[model samples]
Target: MKNLPQKVRSKKLSSRVDLTAMVSVSFLLIIFFMVAAELRKPKVMDLSLPYYDPKWDNIITCSIGVDNRIITVLLDDNNRIVTYSGLLFYPIESPKILSYGKNGIRKELEKRRKNILEYSASMGKPKNGPIIIIKPSKKSNFKNLVDILDEMAITKIDTYAIVNDFTPEEEKLLASK
Candidate 1:
């Protein structure tokens, strides 16, 4: 018999892949996205709503006399704002429709603040500035309320209240418009 070479056999290698690096990379990506989402969170504005007392049967009441220190801002539909200093019936300044921005409500607020400060000084009263009351009618939208609140902040008003209860007179006035 002629000499024959034996058949050479090739070694079989395992086909399993190493997934350690891939899993680690996926975890890192997940963490990065979570951190990014947290960093991109929206800003929030702090608002203080009026506190109610159960003891008081009538929460909304008219001032006994006209208070020059108080300013009432009524938010109506169609982006209309009615502002008056003191009582609506006996306002120091008559109610007028005002729009938003520097030329509109902002100007009026600044002017009123100046006038109120001057009046307080003249009367030998404390310079506590004017108290603003914001009333949003049912017809009004949330954006108007937010705009008004932003105005309050821009004007550096420290004292303000959001009163949803509209006076009958205010309702009538809004209805007239």
Candidate 2:
């Protein structure tokens, strides 16, 4: 009777495997790597950034004020207000800044580069390049800064810095010049 009348009982089980241990290991590895990795912030490795590098030690800075169409040339370590020159201005109604994007500004940038090269060469500097700092005014309205930024990006200029403050006379000088 035990061999012939034994009733079969079927037990159903789910096919999915329990991933608790695997998930625990994954989280543990993430924590391990996070703790093992360095804690310092990364620095950008390219472009016109002013570094302690002696090559750019005596670097020059220039400014384009919002009051008018004057480009100021700054000198010295203190970054003091220096002589301002140049008349590459466009009327406010039709400012020379590129519309939509920097395709137009690219050409202007080339001209500026050539002009800067000439100026640097005339000054007998080591290289004929534009290592310039652009300081646009706070009241700037033409949005030329955007185009300049786009141009800088396209030209791979990552090291450039911006100056934001200036004196009343600086504005006056910019306006008169």
Candidate 3:
């Protein structure tokens, strides 16, 4: 029996896992997450710009000046804002200097907002207040800017812009102050 030729037995090969489905599933999941992420963006504030009118004149301009402190300058039609009026193109009054906090700018803004609402009601027009122009000088500090913006939100005042230009009169006022 030892010298006789033995019959050869074939060995079975081990089966290998097909990873194509797993890879495809993984890719699909990655794509789904990427697309979903795009759809889940954070909400932001909505802003509506006014139509430019050549005749529209009475606009409120706020200037921020910093010289070891904060100075808030409110102007109407290039004149200072002593009172808040709903109409545009009003005459220039002496610009008022406002401090920060509850007793200062905040109070002034609240008063102005009240006046504006009242004026709008009397005029039988929508209570859309005047557009505010904000000019932040290089001397102004970050806190001052933040405070002004906060005051705007608190007063529910919209339609404001942060511009860099300063008129000659505004420059003179800053220098004098």
Instruction: Name the best candidate (by lDDT).
Output: 1
Q: State residue 57's C-alpha deviation in candidate 2, in Å.
A: 23
Q: For model 2, what is the alpha-carbon lDDT of residue 23?
A: 100
Better of 1 and 3 by lDDT: 1
Candidate 2 global lDDT = 0.47
lDDT of 2 by residue, 46-99 (tens): 233323334435643223222122233322221122333342232222223233
Each model's number of backbone clashes? 0, 2, 4
Residue clash pairs of candidate 1: none
Clashing residue pairs in candidate 3 are 57-89, 58-88, 58-89, 79-92
Prediction RMSDs, each to the true structure? 10.1, 12.2, 9.4
Model with the higher TM-score, candidate 1 or 3: 1
What would the per-residue lDDT of candidate 3 be over residues 88-111, giving only the tens digit for each residue? 223233356656678876787676
List the candidate 2 regions with Cα displacement exceeding 4 Å.
1-105, 115-128, 141-144, 156-159, 167-169, 173-177
Which pairs of residues clash in candidate 2, taking residues 3 or more apart in a chain or in different chains? 48-159, 49-159
Residue 60, model 3, lDDT: 31
Error of 3 at 23 (Å): 38
Q: What root-mean-square deviation over C-alphas does model 1 reach?
A: 10.1
